[model samples]
Target: MTLDPEDSKLITLARAARARNEAAEGAAVRDETGRTYSATNIALESLTLSAVQVAAAMAVSSGARSLEAAALVTAGEGPSAADTAVTGELGAGALHVAGPDGVLRS
Candidate 1:
């Protein structure tokens, strides 16, 4: 798979967030204005959230009205339904999935 520079950058940011948090997953998203948000999964005794959701929330909180693209770096199968929903609501055509090594998955 070929990634544009922006997508590649998103993957890099997601991977770095995962490594820094030592979490199960990491995700990044770019807003309509080209600002980016990245985050690792949030896990707690009472609540758990996927990295994609957290990244989306960050973008919303930061005043982004629409999404340009989204990427998730994980060992799991693919983006979850909730992840897809968030991207969809923000106007992303699709969610990009990549492995920890930065390889785009099928």
Candidate 2:
């Protein structure tokens, strides 16, 4: 699918986050106000949050009532249900999944 320049930029950010941490995944989201949030997966003994979940949570905590787009960069099959659910709750937008190379996977 063809994405606008902003969404493409989100993918780039997500890819960078993943590459920076050498983590399993990274994610970014654009809010209704055009603000963006980026995060990497957090897997700890006390807490575990997917990259997408963290990105969505960041938007929500930052007073974003809705999202315009979301993206995840991972080597897995696709994004998790938690990711989709968060996006659906915030807004009816597609979940763009990309590989480490910034190629959209889903």
lDDT of 2 by residue, 1-106 (tens): 7888999999998999898999899999999989999999999999999999999999999999999999999999888788889899999377889888888877
RMSD of each: 0.9, 0.9
Off by over 4 Å in 1: none
Q: Highest lDDT among the candidates is held by which one? A: 1
Worst 10 residues of 1 by lDDT: 93-102
lDDT of 1 by residue, 25-94 (tens): 9999999999999999999999799999999999999999999999999998989999999999999855
